[model samples]
Target chain A: MLKAIKGIPLYLLALFLFIVTGLPFLIMFLTSFKGQMEFMTSPWSFPESFSLDNYKLLAELQFFGYFANSLVVSVVSVIIVILIAAMASYPLARLKFRLNRPIFILFMVGMMIPIHTTLVPIFILTNKMGLYDSLFGLIGPYIAFALPISIVIFTQFMRDIPKELEESAKMDGCSHLRLFWSIIFPLLTPAVATVAIYNFIHIWNEFIFALVLTNSTQNATLPIGLREFYGEFSVNIPGIMAALTLGSLPLLLVYFIAQEKIVTGLAAGSVKG
Target chain B: MSRLQEISLDTVHVRKKKKNKDTWVIIGFIAPAFIIYGVYVIYSIFMTFYYSTFDWTGIDANMVFVGLDNYIQLFQDDVFWTSIQNNFLLVIASLLTQLPVGLIMALLLFSPIKGMRLFRSVYFMPFLMSTVAIGILFIFIYEGNYGLLNAILEGIGLESLQTAWIGKESTAIWAVIATVCWQFAPFYMILFRATMVGIPEELYEAADIDGASGWQRFKSITLPLLKPIIITSAILSVIGSLKYFDLIYVMTGGGPNNSTELMATYMYKQTFTNFNMGYGSSISFSMFIIAFIVTVFILLGDRSTRGNG
Candidate 1:
C-alpha cells in the first residue's frame, strides 16, 4: 500500500509530461476531423463526427505532388549521401595521406557552420547553373549539408572494421575500389541505416533550402507545401489542421513502424558527436 | 657495397611510385564528397563573405564594391542587435528548459510505471514531426479566439491569464520559446535516456545496499555519469538555438514588432524580401562567426574541465 502511494507522484508526473507533450498532437488529430463551425464552437472538444472531408479536400489540392517531391528529394539525397559518404570514409578512416587529418577536420567544421551562411552563395550558384527553382537545385545543397554528419558516422563505424579484413583482401590484389565495395561497404549496414533515417527525416522536412531554391508548387517539398496550405486555407482552421496532421503523418507513421531503429539511430547519430 | 646501395635505392624508387598510386586512390575516394561539400558549403561560405562586400540586389548586375560598409551598418543596426539578443535568450532558454525537462522525462521512462512503451512512443512523436507542422499547429493553439490554450485556461478559471500568446510582444518570445522546448525536449530525453541506459545496473544495486535515497543516487551516480551527454546536449541546444529559423519564421515571422526576430529570420527578410543581399550576407556571416566562437569556447571549457577531473 505504501509503495503504491509512493508511486502516485511518479504516475502524476509522467501523466503531466505526457499530456504536455501529447495534447497538441491529440488536439491536432481530433481537430482535423472537425468541421469549421464545429471547431469554432468547441476547439478543445472531440469532433462531432469523424469526417474524411478535410482529407478529401487535401487530395483535391494535389497534396501527393508535394509528397512525391519530398520523397524523391529525400531518397535521392540519402542514397547519394550513404554511397559517397561511405566511400569517402574508407580513405578518411583507413588511409595514410598528407591531408587526411586536415580534410577530416574540414568536414567536421562543416557541422558548426550555420546553414544561413551558405544560403546566399548557394542560391546564386543554383541560379547561375540554370538549376534554380528546380528539385535538382535542392539536392546539391542537401547532399552537401548532410555530408558532415554522415561522414562522421561512417568514418567512426569504419574505423572499427578489423584491419585484417583489408590486409587479407589486399593480399588477393583487391583494388581500393573493389575492396571498399566488397568488404567495407557491406559492413556499414547499421551506420547506413542510421545515416539514412537521420537524413531522411531532416531532408523530408527541410525548409530553408526548399523555400529559397524552389519557386513553384510543383517543386515545393512537404514543408513548403504545408506552409502553402496554411496560406491558402488560412480561414478554415480544421483544413489547416488536416494539412498539418497529414504533413506530419509520413514521419509519424514511419516512426511507429520502425520505432526502435529510429530511436537508436537518432541517439547514435548525435551521441557520437 | 655499391650493389647493396643500388638495391636499397631501387626499393625506395618503387616505394615512391606505390605512394603516388595510393594518393591517387585516396583522391578518387574523397573527390565526390569533397567537391560537393567544397562548392556548396566551404566555397559558398567564402562567397558569402565576398558578397558581403558588395552593393548589389541579387537580381541585378549592378555591383558596387562597398568594402566593409555592410558589416559597418550591421554594427549600428538596432534590429540586428535585437535579433542577437533574442538568439542568446533562446540559447539560455533551451539549455535551462530542454535539458532538465528532458532529464525528468527520461527519468520517468525508467520509473515503476505502467505502459512505458506507450509513453516513450508518444513522447518521441514531436521530434519526428516537421518543424513547420509543429509551428502551424501551435499557431492555432495560441490563437486568441477558439484556441485550445485559452479554452483550457477559461475552463480552469484562469481567464485573466489568457491572451493572444503569440500576438503580443511581451509573451511572443516566451510563447515561441515554449514551443521550441516542446519540439526539442524529447530529443534531449532520448539522448539522456540512451546515456542513462548505459550506466551500469550494479552501481544502482550498490547504492541501494548502502541505503542511498533516490535523489542521492541520481545526484551522485546518474548526474556524474550523464556529464558527457549533458555537455553534448548543451552544445547542440546552443548551436541549434543560435541558428533557429523554421519554427520562429512559421509561427510569427519575427512579428508583433520584431519581438521574435532571430538572426536567420532577419537575414531572410533582408535578402529575400527586402532585397538587401549584401546586408543579409553580413548578418549571416555574423551568425557563422557567433556560432563558431561559441562552439570553440564550449569545447575549450569541456577540455579544461575534463583535464582537471
Candidate 2:
C-alpha cells in the first residue's frame, strides 16, 4: 500500500522504455499506409487517409508465393522435428539405456556448433544433392538445428513425468510402443507446442540459409522475398514499408495469440540451458 | 536336466531375447533425429573443417589440398581481424548495455505498477518480430533524407546530430549495434524478470524493516540471488553476439566498406560473395573454436565465482 506512489515513477519509466523501444514498430506501421507524397512531406504523421495500395502492389508481385513457401517450410520442418524429437527423447528421458547419455551429449554438441559454421558445407551438400534453389532444401538443415533444442526440451519435460504412471501402464500388460503412443505422447502436448512454436519462428524468420540455398524468386521465403524486394524496390519507400509490415504480420499474430507460451517457452529454453 | 537348472536357463534365455528387442526399439526411436542431425549438423561441421584444409573455390568439383594455408592466411587477413574486433565490441557492448538495460527494465517491472502486463508484453515486441523485419524497419528509420531518426532530431532542434546512420562507414557498426541491442535487450529482460520473480519476498521485507534503501537491498539481496542466471544470460548474449548475422546482414550487408562485418557475415561474404570456400571454412572453424572457448571460459568463471562465494 505504501508503494502506490512509487508506482508513478515506475509507470513513467515503463512508458519511456515502451515508447523508445516500440517507436520503430509504430513508425513502421504508420509509414506503411502513407503515400509517397505524404511520406516525403510528413514522414512521422499518422495516415490522413488509410491506403492498402502498397499491399495491392505486393500481391501483384506474387507475395503470396513467398508467404506459402515460408508457411510450408516452417510448418513441415517443425512437424518432422517434433515427431523425431519426441520419439528420441522418450527413451533417453525415461528408460535406462546404455547409449542414453552418449546420445544426449551428441545432441548437446549441435547446440554448441554455431549455424554459421555449418552453413558453407550445408550449402555444398544441398547443391550436391540437387536441393539447392528448392524450398525443400531448407527443411533438412532446419530440422537438424531444430532437433537439438527440441530433444533437450522434450527430454527435460519428459523427465518430470512420474515413473509410477508408466509402471502402472506396464502392469496392465501394455507394450512399450503402445504405452508411448497412448499415454506418453498425449502427455507431451504442452512441451510439443513449445518446441513447435520455437522451431516455427526459427524457420520462418531464418535468413542466411534461405538466402544461400534458394536463389529463385519462386523458391524465396518471406525473409528472402522481403530482402529482395527491399533491394530491387528501394525507391518506393512506402511499398517496402508495407512489405515489411505484412511480412512480419504472421509472426506478430503468433506472438499475440501465444504470448504467454512464447515468452515462457523461450525463457524455459534459455533458463534451463 | 535338474528342475532348478532348467528354470534358470529358461529365464536367462527369455531375458536375452527381451534385451535384444529393447535394443532395436531404442535404435528405432532415436534413429530419425540422429540421422538427420548427423548428416546436416555434425557431419557438416566436420566437412567445414575438412574443406578448410583444401584450396578450392566452391564453384567446381575439383579441389587441391592446402593443409593449413587457408588458416595461415585467415590469421594474416586484416579484414578478418577487423571482424573479430567488431564481434568483441558487440560482446562488450551487450555486456555493458543490453544486460544492464534489461536488468533495469526487469527491476522496474518487479513492482506492481499500472498496466504492468501491457508494458511487459509491449517491451518484448521488438524481440518477437523477425530480425529481417527489424532490419528493414531500421533501414527506413535511418534513411538520410527523410528517415524518422533525422526527423526526430530536427524536430528536437538537434539538426547537427542528424547524419546518414547506416550509410557512413564510421557510424554503420554503431548504428547496427544499437539495433541489435534494441532487438535483444527485451530477450534478456524477460529472462531476468523470470528469475527475479522466483526470489522470495520475505528477504526484501526484512531488508525494509532494517532500513536498507532500495539500492542496498537490491545489491545485497536480488543481485546475489540472481548470480547464476546473470552468468547464464551473459553467456547467451556473448555467444549470441559472436554469431550475430541476420540483422546486421540485412541492415548493412556488413557494408559501407565492411564496417559492420561480424564474424558470421564475414564468413558468409568470404564463402558466398568471394567464392573462397576454403578460406570461408577456416573463418567458420575459427568462429566455432572461439564460441567453444568463450562458453568454456564462462562456465569456468561461474565455477570459480561459486567457489569463492
Best by TM-score: 1
Instruction: Please give, for residues A127-235, the per-residue lDDT of candidate 1 as tens digits.
Output: 9999998999999999999999999999999999989999999999999999999888989999999999999989999999999999998999999999999999988
Question: What are the TM-scores, per candidate, against the unseen true structure?
Answer: 0.98, 0.95
Interface DockQ per candidate: 0.66, 0.65
CAPRI tier for the interface of model 2: medium
Global local distance difference test of model 1: 0.93
| Candidate 1 chain B, run of 10 with poorest lDDT | B211-220
Clashing pairs in 1: none
In order, candidate lDDTs are 0.93, 0.88
Candidate 2: regions farther than 4 A off? A1-8, B1-10
Q: Which candidate is the best by lDDT?
A: 1
**Ten residues in a row with the worst lDDT in model 2 chain B?**
B108-117
Under the 3 Å rule for N, CA and C atoms, how many clashes does model 2 have? Answer: 0
Candidate 2 lDDT over B130-223, as tens digits, reads 8888998898789898888899899999999999999999999889888888988998998988888788889879888898877788889889
